[model samples]
Target: MKKSLSLILGLSLCALCVGTSFSQAAATQTVNLAVNSVQKIAITGGVITLTISNGTAGNNTLTPVSDATSTYSITHNSATPLRITANLDAALAAGYQLQIALAPGALMGTSAGTVDISNALAASAVAVVTGIPKGADAGRTITYTFNANASAGILTSTAKTVTLTLTN
Candidate 1:
């Protein structure tokens, strides 16, 4: 034939120009995502009970005529600044001691009692108050004031268990 039909029409026009140059060539890629920042807290008057009237032997200690307030109603979603601590899962027999404070105004600014947390009940955590100003105020109502000491003779009747924490 005419050179085999001109080499089969030049190999079918070079395979249709290499399949239309890879089908008109095209490619792309791009993706990204990120998010992080969390700190939450919530409290609603855990528990409170005090009945001083038994301190007399030698060192006697019983206070609760003025400072005996308790108020807690917080909710958090924190964005930063925050610090409220208190602990006493056990302890409070020998002599006795419990003098917490944070009722001065509220926001932890300080003033009223001046943030004094003595005895600490026991266990651990005993910060009392801090900056605490980032958000998560919610209902907002934190007032704590409890005083009771007995070292003189150390009577008897005693019970302690307090905890209200939120740190950052």
Candidate 2:
């Protein structure tokens, strides 16, 4: 009987230890997360064409041509305000002019409205959209106007690159 009692006590203690060990079994891991700054800009719509082929009778000044078929979209998360600037790859010749305008989006930025960027360069870019907040502005219209005086007669067909930049 004493042997049987000692065996029963040992079994009970062993069961208790096993249950405690099973209950204490667990694992943990550390997870990390972060978000980086984002700044992006894109242009939509295909190539645009502007031809000056009309003028008033007996008028020395040829009529200006305009095309507004292009659009631009932007996404930025800057803490402070940002701006959109425009420039040409090369300056227009004398008596020829190229102008541009951007329509402002809802709560996006303020439009400069019809800026002459004929001779603008990267170092001296013209600001087309200013006071831009941190968000996405989509489907904003881009207008380009081309003009030439009578003095710049019969200029051969030429291509000029217009560059739009988003900056501080």
Q: lDDT of each model, Cα atoms only?
A: 0.56, 0.90
Residue-level error in angstroms, candidate 2, position 10: 10
Candidates in order, TM-scores: namely: 0.28, 0.84
The pairs that clash in candidate 1 are: 59-152, 59-153, 60-152, 61-149
**lDDT per residue (tens digit) for residues 1-168 in model 1:** 999999999999999999999889988988776545555555556555555664456644555433333454444445666666776767555444565655423563332233434445445566665666654454344454444565444345555556767676
Each model's Cα RMSD? 11.9, 3.2
* Ten contiguous residues minimizing lDDT sum, candidate 2: 41-50
TM-score of 1: 0.28
Candidate with top lDDT is 2
TM-score of 2: 0.84
Clashes of each: 4, 0
Runs in model 1 deviating more than 4 A are: 1-35, 40-59, 62-83, 100-127, 135-164
